[model samples]
Target: MITNEYINRAIDYILNHIDEEITVEDISNYCCFSRYYFSRIFKMETGESIYEFIKRVRMERSAFRLKVEKDRSITDIGSAYGYSSSNYSSAFKKHHNMPPYKFRRSIVHKSMMNPVFRNTQTELLTWQECSEKITVEIFEDCTVIFERYKGSYGDLSVHWGAFLDKYKEYITEQTRILERSYDDPAITLPDKCLCDICIDAPAGCTLENICTIKGGRFAVYHFSGPVEHIYSAYQNLFSVWLPQSKYKIDDSYGFEIYKKTDCGSRHMDIDICIPVK
Candidate 1:
């Protein structure tokens, strides 16, 4: 993960205004570095040039919206990212290997609320169990230091351990460990997923990779089980409970606050929080 404050600021800007037009020159100037130098170091630390990273994030987030915001029209979704309908379809197909409509269709069919489906992949929660575990709650904004990791979600424990170890000095009784995921696993390929393992930062800490987590309304589910069982919780949460709820998921991004962790047992006590409107 990059500890460069300049790159961190640039990434924050990109995510905040992902719906708006962005250019390398704009980001370079915002970081107060020459465009060439900023681009070079960003690529060196992130493995993707500035434009490539922005494009990938836009594509992933748009694809995620396709899954969640089913009532929203494709044209409107594409337009939000400054893509014309035709261009969006072409680009989405090239990036995801299928047109946007098909991708949405597949998700609908795949996530049918089969009682048996919950038993298999999720291996933990029935509809009733999930219903009992979830609630709508408000969250306060927090500043956090995070390490962005890209790749398979199933293999993140080692990365988490290393990051926590590196920043061990900052840990405290009141601190919270959070994991903010930026892509839908069902849509984005496992190797291409992006996430951050983060912890609350103290005031005026001056950490290099720090950013504010803008908090608001959230559907927070309390879960305690083997980490493998989490798949079912999420499936049941979004596929079942969320659709029936009065609230709609907003674009603020969902995150997990780890209340307890036992990596050796592959177990966790975590609050799964998804932003809502």
Candidate 2:
């Protein structure tokens, strides 16, 4: 079996050098293993060939930048991830079933046709059911180590449980437990949604998976109730309060800050922090 340390070092190398050209031989050298042996071990552990994994990660990163960085050119974004313009467009089209430009356009179109926009009238009528006060605050940037999960939002508890168990030793009084959902469930398919279960890590701490949450203005809503009701609270925030507010939701991922949980009572208190501009 391949050792965890070897796999972790390889992953770290890939993440850190994603913007540069990387090859199987380079990874093998970094791990101080033969190329043939490393390739087999990597595939066994990650379920993908090293080349396949690199391509997928680059495409995912490109898709994210295409959606958020409206001012950047598609060609520039493609080149940053080590792809020529033509090759990037062709690969992106094959992977996403649409051209990059088309994909970017779809984002704007989807936002307009979002569930929140369509149900604004009905949401206004039932807004009282979720009438919770929202507060605006300036949040500082945070460094977090996270585990990514892709599936139905309802299944996050399973992921969270596993994450806590795996990283229990890293837990501390100052470590903040948070979840960042990258895609809007209302706009994307439930099974395709991307979510990350993260914990704030101290500076200079290196991990297998880490990302920086950008700091900015945010609209915070506090919810204290059964976990099932959390969806309704979000629906009210997006469909009701957001449309009527002065600020517009930004492109950054929205996160949930877990405050307290009562297993016996099946209740939880969490703050939903949505980035705003």
Q: Best lDDT goes to which candidate? A: 1
> Which segments of model 1 are wrong by more than 4 Å?
108-120, 123-129
How would you encode candidate 2's per-residue C-alpha lDDT over 47-124 as one tens digit per residue?
678888777766766776676566679999999898899999999998778889998877544443334233432222
The per-residue C-alpha lDDT of model 2 at residue 34 equals 97
TM-score: model 1 vs. ground truth: 0.87
In order of listing, the candidates' clash counts read 1, 0
Which pairs clash in model 2? none
Q: State the local distance difference test value for candidate 1.
A: 0.81
List where candidate 2 sits over 4 angstroms from the true fold. 1-3, 108-154, 162-175, 178-257, 261-277
Model 1 is weakest, by summed lDDT over 10 consecutive residues, at: 111-120
Error at 111, model 2, angstroms = 7.2
Tell me the whole-model lDDT of each prediction, alpha carbons only: 0.81, 0.73
